[model samples]
Target chain A: MKAKPKQSRYLTLVLILGLIAACTPPAEKTAEPTSIVEADPLPSWNDGPRKEAIISFVEDVTDSASPNFIPVADRIATFDNDGTLWSEQPIYFQFFFALDRVKALAAEHPEWKNKQPYKAVLENDMPTLMQQGEHGLLEIVMSTHAGNTTDEFDSLVRSWIDTAQHPVKKRRYTELVFQPMLELLDFLRANDFKTFIVSGGGIEFMRPWVEGVYGIPKDQVVGSSIQTEYDYNNGKPIIKRLAKIDLIDDKEGKPIGINRYIGRKPVFAAGNSDGDLQMLRWTDANPLMSFQLYIHHTDSLREWAYDRDSHIGKFDIGLDEAIEKGWTVIDMQTDWKIIYPFEKNQ
Target chain B: MKAKPKQSRYLTLVLILGLIAACTPPAEKTAEPTSIVEADPLPSWNDGPRKEAIISFVEDVTDSASPNFIPVADRIATFDNDGTLWSEQPIYFQFFFALDRVKALAAEHPEWKNKQPYKAVLENDMPTLMQQGEHGLLEIVMSTHAGNTTDEFDSLVRSWIDTAQHPVKKRRYTELVFQPMLELLDFLRANDFKTFIVSGGGIEFMRPWVEGVYGIPKDQVVGSSIQTEYDYNNGKPIIKRLAKIDLIDDKEGKPIGINRYIGRKPVFAAGNSDGDLQMLRWTDANPLMSFQLYIHHTDSLREWAYDRDSHIGKFDIGLDEAIEKGWTVIDMQTDWKIIYPFEKNQ
Candidate 1:
């Protein structure tokens, strides 16, 4: 049948529209998608004031027209490693590494069987170790952590992490990372923030596995370090770890470490203990729109809950400051849908 | 006035070819372009073996099908800043900063009028300052460099650099940067290499201006630093720079600094003095295909030419090693057509 000129023109218009639609991405078709299919950058974070605050802050800072908008280069976020990003309940995970290292090296150092801290570590005498305090910890750390090239130390750490399991959880140490924190990291990175791990743990120990575990590169992880010397053995340059401490990145040292390593004030800082108080305060002091978050350990069922009186990761000063300063205090017990990644299947 | 079916089909083929050609970028049209419009990534470099070697190495490493192909994450390049990147004549540029700072602060201390190093700096007596040696240098450095908060120090440095001029050439210190080296940095970055400045100068002193001058961000600069303490002065967190040295970042300290800061050995390294020998050797020791380059000061007319005899940036050990190890030695007189970027217009 012959078609009229108006009908033919209408048919051409429909064909052109179809072609244009075909070239466009499927996700661009709708202005908004239903909640079920919508992208959740922070999927593990439940709907709460804390989560909303974070979202709103990120959106405001990244919006070009917003007064709070910060350039992408200035979007620095720092995370405290121990209790903030992972479990540090019974003790710091690094202490376990030190203890295990003492046991592993005790065979070669027969005198360690008679030494105070080494003997205590070998016999699992926590009381004696505690009595010795910082001195005892230093002895154990110096013995196990030094006197090897960086490459040798890195290999040792890599192997130890591969086999080490948490005593209570019976899971690989790397698997204990907080799932919600991981989501937060991704969300911040997606919004053009450069995330760094500012930790009190050994820098070398964390550098070996940080990229694999947290997706933070080795250079981006700043932490405590022992003195090292550059030497040539067999005509090849090597950096030998010395027993003396270079920088203790704990307590007040956190802010110093961030300034030394990053050379810029972070806009966002998250921490869990008093060790991170100075870091939080530093970030809060920024004139720009800043976010200071503290992960409060209130989940006794899902995770160990302790603060103020805890031997490890004591959270007294920082908790008081967060409350007084109106910083976001994440009630882990209520806010998190899942604690560790392994909890997803269960 | 009628076309044959075969002729009509040929016309349709030509139209299809034209549409495909229109969609492709202009650069893709030709496999290569001759000198006039060719992409010379290192335009400051003259046509010679040194330039060819660099281009060939970059091409080999970036080619996915080649055995020498390096992943972007593994493509690390470290450059020594003082003599290699910029002029170190009339003493290292940082010493001038220290001297100026001493004069600026001299009025505060009446005792400084008699103090050996401070007195020499105030009098502009170079001979006495040299006589004081390392001990005298440390005294001058500590008096001028420490005791201020990191932010305060940054502002002071920024202000000083904005107004300071070279003692001899009278150019801004930043303007003395080598043009060829700047081009090399861009070339390396274009090939996906993460470039870092590993200097023996003060980290804080360099951080304020490096981003603007070198295109290398503050976080990527590794250098000597004094100890810093995090303290609260009236409820505000501040990092106070202390008098004591934390790291030297010279000679054997270069490798130690690299290990502590970068945590990964660079696949490429460039330097111009004995201080950088260990760094280059450490880079060469990497298991990957690597490149080591040294810039030899051979241009006396355009720039000050001093090497082994010069107290500043002495190149004795490194010059010998470069020849013996078959590393690229860039003869500044012959290899460079222009020295500094400011010379381009002239």
Candidate 2:
């Protein structure tokens, strides 16, 4: 087999190529309905009062004959993006994007080398960045996100998402999304529910990848964003981005955002943190077959679990409220069949 | 013929009952789809670049096999709640709710009897109320919206919507929603598109009835809101509303609100007036299949037709930009199969 050095090297290359080709996932197939009733992802969910309550609500409301049957135009459901539909462990996904943006845009703005958050970001100094806190995060986001028009900003976001990878997980940021939650989104949409991602992240940050990752179109995603200014330059008009925080979209802001943006009260609401408490409360208060669910991160093996004290994606107050209010608290370790699509038990 | 008096009275009673029964819709069929479909609601739409573009985009994005195939989770589609989804011809729906709220709450707070906007609202003096401008509207909203938790405020709104009637339309505000737009929302949801209502209306004012009107749930609604305080009163913590304008969900505010609330850019957006232009602009900036539709009120018979100068839902700058930008401009009169779902149309 080792006839010559050159011959052996060529043989090794061929074998490596063959293995790589075999390991690659087959081209994605056309998703088709295999059966009308195939499988239930959350089979452990008991057919008790809570579960039946949802089913009966949907049935009675969706039924045209029932006085309670709501029109199809009104079957809206809203879910918080971070922690609710996707995992927000260690840090938020958007913050990672911000850090990457800071690094990418740093070379152009060498002044950022001395800046607080950017300096911290470029040096991979998490502790320093944390010290800078929300104001620092805002500065970093504004510096990296501003100066460009909305169009240019969107491109930057899209490019970064396409190339960025989570440092710890060594996976694309999109791959970090929870699989069971993804299935839940699909299930809701399949049942005529209009699902929305109401998050406190930058609006433009999620718009680029949400369609590809969450199946939610850009318009359906509501998030926090910076202020913008429209002006004329060289006889041409253009909109320029400004670093100022236009609105803060968290906590009580959720209900306000929902009211202004969606102009409706959701029949169903889901979140993983206290930031979404008001949204859940507002939804539950409605005189409809409404439901609210909270995601509890309790598993450390599959993912980090630090609920009582976490700088980002805190879940302490909301978790207690969920329990006290008899809300459906999804036990990440016990309930979820799979946490993420990319990971398999080692 | 001599027995005509008794016979006439009996016959009149039967006729009156028949008319009343006719006014009400046939008991909605329990098994029927929640809203109308297959009506080809927008028949005047040419099978040209504009119409086909949207249809093809939706079809391709929903195919699952296509490269543009969006996941069900990311199928969020945002809409402008005013003219785009319903009639904002002579007045905004919130204005109507405000007027009624002012009158209902007037006798209790007689000081409003001498107030500017409140007095105007109480006396049905819309002209004076309009003059109070956005400031007046905010005042009215705050006065009616304050002194209660979000839950209590929502109940008040619900009760008002359930009973209030539009002066000219003489129908519940819920019935004022455009039939075609309602179908569009349903169609999108059926195809896994999550629909939302983004508006300049007060958040608390709209959430109570939006689900009933637009099929958009409370949490899916985003709108302008005031600052609130959550406190424990009488051993029960309650979220009290305030008069301070925390945020305005219109124009530039739209994009920021979109960011803060939905966390993703919408693939599709439909709006009328300059308030929605930035939202449309933001949505169009997405890399994937995207669309921005403008509702041009061109039908005076079924609905009012005035662009560029209408005070209520003005469409001057937006109309020009839409045409130049190649956005879908729906000529409401010509394109619609029916303006509203009423006895005559149905």
Candidate 3:
């Protein structure tokens, strides 16, 4: 689907990781459960309104005596996967998966070394790739993401996520997640709030490994998608992925995706960019007492910090709105004692 | 979207009720718990292979020592709506909803009495209404179902469902759901199987009350949809419903819907028509020890029974496939002690 120019490149990014370790998925969803004793739900935080806001909101909503008390089933919390829950510096992670796939399959498609977008990807030229815009990105993504059975694609993501290293940070992409956010996810789940990931990344790409990394399950994660076909090859049944786009799941799409997938309005929402504006606003507009937070990536040393003029995960207009609404804007350098999960070990 | 002519009229129905009360939805989801003790997981099911097959399959898959043992997270079970879980005789309940909405809105649009499809509806003319074909039905459905805020549509359905009576059955549409299936849903939940409704009905239509009616939460429901927009209505954010079609979720679309929403193939699937053949085949195709069932509507005296030639939920090809695959064909009259929950009152 060729989207309107304004709804262009940003629409199709689909990120799908959850909890890192809940349901034993504490790796996020299934691998290693992030260990937390009952004493402190969020230990990584330095302690302030940024941290207190999360605790106070949870306490008020879960407290039956409070006027803000929301029932367990109605207590839905949505978070943007990229930047908000983890890092999306330099560029989005799924884009890396696309570029890596192009390079991996370069040997198969000999002509790709000469092709425009394919050439840009093969040479690891970010500047050239940026010029291709949404069209180029879609071409690269569809070539690698589509054209396989769902099970085959699942294994592809699983293998890649296990060994793939972040280009700049030189850390496993999963380990780059904010420790405070992970604790927040666990804290919310502990309070009977059903947490979900609403992203602009591929739904399939995220489902493969999010559980072990986020404790969020496959079903709880919603993201942008491509069309799929149910194929009956003689006797075997397989879902064949089609290159055609299904949902964009970005900007205004966040709330639309929530309605399609989650149904009820989320009382809690968190995001990091202009892309997340609609979701935060939607949460703020909920009839129930709601909480909205904007994660300000201000820690230039611990994490890449970019806003206003930055291209990837820009946080300009959303930041303005967060401040205007009196929503919590966490200044990362001042608020967090540490950033990544690996920092805790150090 | 003008669908392929073959995929026309049947593409837009969205039935959203589940375990009537599963989360307490045992009403299949919530109003009443149905008062079943742990002793009998399925009291409505008669003592036969149809019943025994369910017990054995569950025991095998849930048993840790059994070769068929599936991990708890992997225990997904999907079901078809309409005839499989509830009654779809005469026509789909959503069609009834469309008709009623048209009638309710008729006082505002006197021009409808003179219009073709709406005139056909106002006159209570089925054959004339059927003659309007898919385009006419879409016109009727879109007129009533679309153009409202999502919250408004939610309230509309809620108000209508509370008071509306089934034209023929005389009972409420929710009351027409199968007693045995409700028991089956509760049974599966007890054993750790995650049950879902994979229907061709409207996603929004089912979300509001399904948790109370089927015990399945709002997020668990997946069905056909139209486009919606996130409008900041003077800062009062609302998801505005659009008449544009989204997903059809029928036939081959069933497996596609399963992939899009649940992101996993079900180990058990049940249905009553050819529309569900792909889902049943998809479940049967699962690499696990899967179970497939076709509810053969065969008891006219107790419940309306029509099979191969029935217009609403024809069960010809699916029934033949079930028998050939050696899968269970639930003989409704013989296999069920009661067809509906109300029968228990008598």
Leading candidate by lDDT:
3
TM-score of 3: 0.91
Q: Which tens-of-lDDT digit does each residue in B168-278 have in candidate 2?
A: 667887777777677678768878787878887777777777766777766677777776664434434356677665656777667756665666668899998887887
Return the lDDT, model 3, position B329: 95
Go through the candidates in order and give each one's C-alpha lDDT. Answer: 0.79, 0.66, 0.80
lDDT for model 1 comes to 0.79
Residue A217 C-alpha lDDT in model 2: 63
On DockQ, the stronger of 2 and 3 is 3
Native A-B interface contacts kept, per candidate? 0.75, 0.21, 0.81
Backbone N/Cα/C clashes per model:
0, 61, 86
Model 1 Cα lDDT, one tens digit per residue, A225-250 = 88777778878878888887666676
Candidate 3 positional error at B11, Å: 7.5
Ranking by DockQ: 3, 1, 2
Q: List iRMS (one decimal) for every candidate.
A: 17.4, 15.5, 2.5
What DockQ, between 0 and 1, does each candidate earn?
0.30, 0.12, 0.55
